[model samples]
Target: MTARKEEAGPSGLASALVASGALRSDWLTTFNAVPRGMFVPDRIWPGIADGTRQNPVVDRVRDPVAWLRAVYSDIPLTTQWDDGSHSGDGLGQTPSSSSSQPHMVFSMLADLDVTDGNRVLEIGTGTGWNAGLLAHRLGGGNVVSIEFDPDVAEQAGENQRNAGLCPLVIVGDGRLGYAEGAPYDRVIATCSVGEVPRAWVAQTLAGGLIVAPWGTLYGGEAIVRLTVDGGTASGRFTRSSAFMRLRQQRPDLPRHDVYLKGREWPADGIGSTTTLSPAEVGGWLEQFAIGLQMPGAFWTVERYDDGTYTLWTYSTDTLSWASADHEPGADAFHVVQSGPRRLWDETEAAYAWWDGQGRPGFDRFGLTVDSDGERAWLDSPDHPVRCTDP
Candidate 1:
C-alpha cells in the first residue's frame, strides 16, 4: 500500500454535510443509519468534488485508507465502467455506473419530500445506497428500485441485503418504470433524461412528486421536481446536475466525419467575426438557456497549445456545424458556419435573449410534460422558450 495521510471518517463527513446545508435535520437519522461506505465497492475510481472527472482506481485490499477516505468523501465513486464489460485497473472509455455524490443524494431526497409511509419507486439502483436510505426511512416493503443492468442490479441487491435492508431490486428498463409498483407516492430517478417517460407519470399517483435530472442535448442539466396532476406534470428546477443519461433516452449523434462530408475546414461555409467572446457562453447557466432555446443541438471543445480553444456546435441531423475561435482578451472572435442552419448565430441570439431577461438562473427555469411534449419555461409555464428548427 502506498503511504498517504489519513483523511476524514464517516462521522466527520456527516458533520461536514450538515454544515453545508445538504444533510437536512429531518433526514439525519436515515443518513446516519445507511452509511455510504456499506454500499460502495472496494475498487473505485474516485470522482472530483465539483466535476465529472474520475481519478485512478483505489482498491480497498491494496489501499484501505484511500478507499475509506473515498467512501466518506462527498464526491461520487465510479464503480463499474462500460456497463461492467471492461475489466482493468485503469479507467475505461466511459463510466456506466457509480455511487452518486452524497450532497446530490440528500438534496434530491429533500426535493422528493417523502412522507413516513409513502411508497417510493427509484430508477437506476446503481449502488443501492439510495434504496437503502429510502428503506431506512420508509420500510423495506415500501421501497422498490429498478436497474437496467442485471449485474448492477444483483450487486445492489447483495449490498442492500448485507446492510440488512430489503428494498425490492428489479432488473429492468427504468424508462418503463416497474408497473408492479404503480401508484407510488414518490418516484425518483438517479439517471438523467431528455424526456420524462410517460410510464413514470402514469404510475405516480395524483398529487405525488417525481424528481429527476433533466438535461438537453446541447449540454447542461438540472434537477426537475414535477408535481403530478390529472395526466400532467410541471415543476421548477431545483438545482444544477450532471448525472449519467438514461440509456433509452440517449440521442444518436452523428460522427464528425459525417458532418464534414469529406470537406476541409470551412468548406463552402460563410466566415464572420463577432464581438461576443465564445468564453461568455460556456457557463452552466448559459448552456442551459441556450440549450432550451435551441433543441437538437450539441457542443464540444477543442483546445490548442496556446491556451486558446474552439467551441464547436453541431446539429444532431449532421446537416449544420459551426466553430468559434476563442482567444484570451479578444473582443472579436472568428466564426465559420456551414449547411442550412447557422448554429453560432442561433446560440448568440439565445445568449442575447437570456441577457435581456436579466440573466435568469436555473431556479427561474421550469419544465412541463404533457400530451403535446416537454417544454422548458422561465418564471412561469406560460412563458415558454421559442424552439427553433435544427
Candidate 2:
C-alpha cells in the first residue's frame, strides 16, 4: 500500500469529474464510494489524455506519489501489457488492459442510463472500477461483469471484494454474452469491437441500451449507444474513443513482406500521382469515415527522417495493397497500388464521397445491427453507407 497524497485523493478527483460534467449528481455517490485507486494495481503505465501514448511505469512501492497522482488524474492507467506476457519497467508492445480514463468512464456510464432495479451486464471487467461503480449504483446482484482473462478476472474480483462490492466477475469470452444473466436492462463494453456481437443484442431486453466503443479494423474508434428493439439494434455514436479492441475481434493483419510477395517497391504495381494529401486522410474523423466506407481495408504509416512518410493501406485478405508517399508541402502525392483491387483509387473515392457529404462527424453517424448484419448509416437506417465488402 502507498501513502495517499493530499491533493491526489478521491475527493479532489470527484470534484474535478463533477466540474468536467462527467460525474452526474445521481452517480456522484457511487463515484465517491468506489474510488479508482482502490481498483488500480500498485504498478501501472500512465496513459495520456488522448489515450494514444503511454508513459513509463509508476510503481506504488517505489513512487507512491506518482502512482496516486496517476490514479486521480483524468487520463487512463495501463495495468497490463501484451496480454500479461510483457515484463519489466519499460513500455510493452501493446497495452492489453487498463483502467480507462475517468471522463470516458463516467460519460459512458451516463450514456448507459441505468435506473434503480436495473440489471447491468458489463463486458471487460479490467480493474473492476467500472463494475464497482455499477454495483454501488445498482445492487451488486444486479451487475454482472465478464472478463476474458482469468488472471484479470481474479484480480478484479479481489478488488471488488476489498472495495466491499461483489458484482459477479465471470471468467469467459465477452463476445458471448453471459446468458445465465439474461435480459439485462443495460449492457456496456469497456473494450472496443469492429462489429457488435449478436449475442449482446439477444441478451438485452427490448428498449434496453448497449453502449460501447465501436470502431473499425483500420484505425478510428467511437462510442456508439444502440437501443435494442426486438431483433434489431440501432443508435447514434455518442463520442470518439480509442479503447483496446476486444480480444476475440482483434484482426490478424498481413505483414508488409506478405503484401510485397518477394517483389520490390512498385513491382508490377500501377503508379500515379494524386492531389489528395495523405496527411488530410490521416485525421481521426477522416479515418472514421474512410474506415466505414472501406470495410475490409486498414492503413499504417512508415515515417522517414526527412519529415515525410509512406501511407500503406492493405486489405484484410492480404491480396490488395496501396502506398501513397506523403512529403510535406507536396501538391501531388505519389501513389502505387497492386492486386485485383484498386485500393488507392477506392480510398480516394471514399474520401471524396465523405467530403461531398459534408464530412459528417461521429454524432451524425449511427450503427444498426440486425439479422442481416451490421451497417453504419449517416442519419437514419434508411440511408446506409455503401460498404464495398460486408
Candidate 3:
C-alpha cells in the first residue's frame, strides 16, 4: 500500500512498444493474447529501463495497482534473487530469475523469425511467459522450454497453466539444451551466456536460427542471431542486451588480492601518463569492442571521496594488472602497469581498432561458432577479430 499509485496498463505499454517498433505487427495478436501480467508473481522488483538497478518490491496483495502496472510496463520484473536464497523484499546480491522486459522479449522473438508449425526450443523458462508466448504462436506441442532450477520450472509450469498454455517445461540444465526435442526449427535462449553451448547448435536444424544474448569476460553484451549451418552457427549481433548470465557459465574470477600479491599503490608497477581518460572507454559499445580483443580481462573501479576514481583492470590469470586515475576536469590521466601483460594498453588498442572501423555498432560485429570454438568478426566471417596478446 506504500507504493505510489500510477496511471499505467497494458494498452499504454502496447502503444509505446508499437511506436518503438519492438512490438511488430505480425506478433501483435499473440502479444495481446499472452498478457505478461499472468506470468508475474505476487511480489517483484521492477528494474530500470536501460540499467540493471531495481526498485522496491510491489506486492500484489499490498499494492495490486502498482503490481499490475509493473507487470505491464516495458521493464523487467525480478522474480527471484540470489537463486531464490535471499529474502525480505530488499535487493539481493544478484538477480537470478526474471520476467524479461516486454520490449526485449518481443524484439528477440522478432529476431527468432518463426513461422507456422516451426518447432522451437527455449532455454531458461524463467516465468514461462516467453514459453507461453511461443506456445501461443506455434502449438503447445511445438514448443519446449528448459529450466535448471526445479522450483523455478514448477512455478513456470503453474504460470503457463494459469495462462491456458501448455509448453513442455522440463527441469534440467539449460546449457545442455533438451535433446528429446532435437532438430528444432528454432532455438532461443532467454539467459545470456559467455559461450554458446555446442548442444544448442547440434539440436537446431540446418538454416534454423538461434537467438541469444552473448557477452564477453571483460563486459558488455548483445543479442546474437545465428543461422545454423550443417555443423556450425554464424551470425551478427542484433541489439545490445543485459540478461542474467547463465548459472552454469557464471565466472568465478580471480580476486584482486591475487593480482596485487602484497603490493601497495604503484608498487613494482611502471607509471605512465596517457591522454585517454578512463571515462572515454567505459561506454557499452567500447567495452564490447575491447572485450572482443582483450580476452580474459575484467575491470573494477575505486572511487575517492573527491569525485575521482581509479579504473583497475586485471587479467584473469593474475598475470597482469593496470590502473588509470581519472579526475574530473582533467585533460590527462595517470596510468600504471604491472606484471607481464599491459591490460590498459591492450584495451586502448582495441578501442582504437573499433574507432578505425568507423565505430561499428552491434550489427556490424558477427560471431561464428564451430567445433573448434567461437570467433568474433568485424563485418564478415572472413575478417576475424584479432586478439591482443601479451
Candidate 4:
C-alpha cells in the first residue's frame, strides 16, 4: 500500500470533484465503494486535467507512488494504445481505451440521473470502473455494460471481480446496444460518437434517457443528455468534452495529398484575404458551432517555427479543400480555395451565424434524432442548424 503522505488519495480526488460540483452527494458513497485504483491496469499513461494529451506510461510495478498519485488525480488514464497492438511503454499513435477523468465520469453519471431500481446499459466498458460504480450504486443485476474489445472486456470483468462488483460485461459491438437487456431505463456511452446508434434509442424505454458524448465530423464534442420519446430523441448539450471517437463511427478522412492531386501550394486555387484570424475559429465552442453547419468537413493545422501556421480544411469526398494562412500581429490573413466547395467561406459563414446568435454556448445547441436522421438546432427543434450560402 502506498503511504498517504507520499501522494494524494481518494479523499483528495473526492474533495476536488466535489468542489467542481461533478461528484454529487448522492454518488459519493458509490464512488468510494468502487475505487478507481482497482480497475486501472498495472500500466497507464496519465493525462492532464483539462486537455487530451497523455504523459508517458507509469507502471505501478516500476513506480508505485507515481502510479497511485495518477490513479487518484482527476484525469484520464490511457490503458490501451492502438487497440492493444502497440508494444512497450512509449506513447502510441492513438489512445484506444482509458479510465476516464473522475470529474467526467461522475458528471456523466449525474447526467444519467438513475434511480434505485433503474436498469442501465453502458456502452464501452473500457476499464469497467464506470460499470463498477454503477453496479455499486444500483445492484449488479440492474447494470449491463458492453465492450467491443474482448481482451478489454475480460480485464474489466477481472477488475470488477477484484473490486467485489460484477456488472454483466458483454464483449460485443457497442454501437448495437445489447438487445437482451432491452427497455433499459438509462443508457450511457463512455466513448464518443458522431451519430447516436438507432439501436440505443430502440432498446431504451420511451421515457428513459440516453447520455452520450456526441461530436461532429468537422470538430468539437459535448455530453448530450437525450430523452427518448417514441421513435425520436432530442436534447441540448450539457458540457464540452473530448472523448475518443467510437471505433465504428470514426471517420476515415481523405489525406491532404488526395486533395492537392500532387500539385504545389495554391495550384489553380483562388486566393483571397479575410480579416478573420484562423485562431478565432479554433476554440471548442466555435468548432462545435461551425461543425454543426459544415457537414462532411474537418480541419488540420501545419505549424511553422516563426509563430505561424496554415489551417487546412478538407471535405470528406476529397472534392473540396481550403487553407487559411495565419501570422502573428496581422489584421488580415491569406486564404485559398480549391475544387467545388469553398470550405473556408463555409466555415466563415458558420462562424458568422454563431456570432450572430449572440455566441451562445453548448447549452443552447441541441440535437434531434429520428427516422429522418439527426438535425442540430440552435434554440428550438424547429430552427434546425444547416449550411448557409457562402
Q: Put down candidate 1 lDDT per residue, 196-305, tens digits, no spaces.
A: 99999999999999999998888889999999997899999999998888877777788777888898988877999998898999988899899998988998888999
Q: Estimate the overall C-alpha local distance difference test score of candidate 2.
A: 0.91
- Model 4 scores a C-alpha lDDT of 0.91
In terms of lDDT, the poorest run of 10 residues in model 1 is: 47-56
Error of 2 at 119 (Å): 0.4
Q: Quote the lDDT for 254 in model 3.
A: 89
Q: Write the per-residue lDDT of candidate 2 for residues 1-390, one digit (tens) a residue.
A: 996654877888888889999999999988878989899999898874222454878999999988989899988888998899977877777789999999999999999999999999999999999999999999899999999999999999999999999899899999999999998999999999999999999999999999999998767899999999999999999999999889999888888888998989987789999999999999888899888888789988999999999999998888889999999998999999999788888889889989999989999999999999999999888999886762
Superpose all Cα atoms of candidate 4 onto the true structure and report the RMSD in Å to 1 decimal: 2.9
Weakest 10 consecutive residues of candidate 4 by summed lDDT: 48-57
Candidate 3 clash pair list? none
For candidate 3, the lDDT comes to 0.91
- Global Cα lDDT for candidate 1: 0.90
